[model samples]
Target: MRYRSSDEDSARWDGFPFREGDIIISTRSKSGTTWMQMICALLVFRSPDLPASLSELSPWVDWLIVPRDEVLARLEAQPHRRFIKTHTPLDGIPLDPRATYVVVARHPLDMAVSLFHHVDNLNRERMAELLGGPAPAAPSAPPRSIHDSLVTWINREVAPAEAMDSLPGVMWHLTDAWQRRHEPNVVLIHYADLVDDLNGEMRSLAAKLGIDVPEEQWPLLVDAAGFAQMRARAAQLAPDPVGILKDRNAFFHRGGSGAGRELLTDEEFTQYEKRAAQLAPNDLLAWLHR
Candidate 1:
């Protein structure tokens, strides 16, 4: 399906509907969207009964797959917990005081690497089949290179998804939210912490929502949702999972940290840091550096 960009100003998000008890995981693409989804699912149901891909259970509300009205209507009609996925920044979303919003933070460098892997395995033929027929020309013109695509979208001009080479755009997206992390309802968790301390973060995530996961069950939940475990379980879970890209193996692609310093060049790091200094809050930048 071709995704149409909303000509409507993100400012009009006030008109977008949100409901009480909704748990919205809003973040830039590939920035731990699935990780937080899994965390939240465990918190809400206390059992990993919601399939492998959380997106199967809770779809991306803003994706072109479903119209906004249908999304709003679905939220309003649903009786069970509604945990929606979104790649839009916070301001673009209608704020619901009653909803629990989690915005996971990943180092821009790591996100870029993850996205690079994302493109490698996309298997356009498979995606074309998934989308039905030939792939649509990227909404914007085809990007000359990945970096060019990043330039196009930051400007919101037009660029092919392939051209969206995000050498530093990933940094821009992260820094933007790092600046906004102070918002009262937005909870920020670092990919590093989430990866390094999965058990701790899982427990912490549960506590943040006032959910008590019995200590013994933590092992069961953690084992079931671990990266390799989840990847192995993907086909069985079926449909789609949040964070798991269009392809199942894509989700488990190189989940690593400290990539910014290791993989990015001094030139690239400079570009990333400069953008952060200009747009990211000083405090958030400090957190990233740490």
Candidate 2:
């Protein structure tokens, strides 16, 4: 399945060279893509002091703004274990047995809320200029409130590959990974778990990636992965290699959960649950909504 969007193209991964022990952070937008990249960086380097910016360390492989050849060259030049980032689903890209695929799942409602803010932060004019496309026209009406936008997002129907940020699209990405969860190279990590227990999650991720950190450095590494810590260093940590964001610090917007849930009525919430059930299996839904 090839995913083609204005900003990305999954076809770019067709000839990607995957080395042994390569880590691919497969996730949807606003679903811990940067967070997992940070975790992998911390674990791979075994230190909070990364050699380069987080975006430079783990480039988004499928993004159209960055030349595919350039992204490949950067990865090839890296000496350390490579951890690449992608918003494409599992089926969209080639699966190499030697490489580990880490899928990060966040609550759909929370993800939707984060995405709402994310869209606002993006500099569409800059993005258009980078992609060599016409500048987007100004909106005729006022932008929808988070509550209204999310309600529409939940009810909107879109083909998974066509709109990876929609409700169906989110489920499509996760369901594909959930089925492969038993595979040795596939690992599933929840955003809520990371938020609830950053240290434990970081340790578990390090163990899974076969990177051993010295006992003395555990506190430093885990603290570096914290939301507040990442926000404080937003200039380097936010995924803004180019000037696509109005404010890099805004990219690290409230990393907490339950904001989406708070905006809905009980009936609306139940409707969302029902819609999710239709799109994903019971076990996957349980894990996602939990």
lDDT per residue (tens digit) for residues 1-290 in model 2: 99989999999999899999999999999999999999999999988899999999999989999999999999999999999999999999999998999999999999999999999999999999999999999999998898899899989988988899999999999999999999999999999999999999998888888998999999999999999999999999999999999999999999988989999999999989989999999999988888
How much lDDT does each candidate structure score?
0.62, 0.94
**Which residues of candidate 1, in runs, are more than 4 Å off?**
1-17, 51-53, 67-77, 123-176, 179-183, 236-246
* 1-290 per-residue lDDT for model 1 (tens digits): 12224211233234656666778886666678876777677767778766434655566766643455665675676676777777666655666788777878777656765666666555455445544557545546543555543333233322222222243434444555566667766677888887788888888767766677878788888876677766676564422432324666555776668654675457766766776566456777788767
TM-score of 2: 0.99
List candidate 2 segments past 4 Å from native.
none
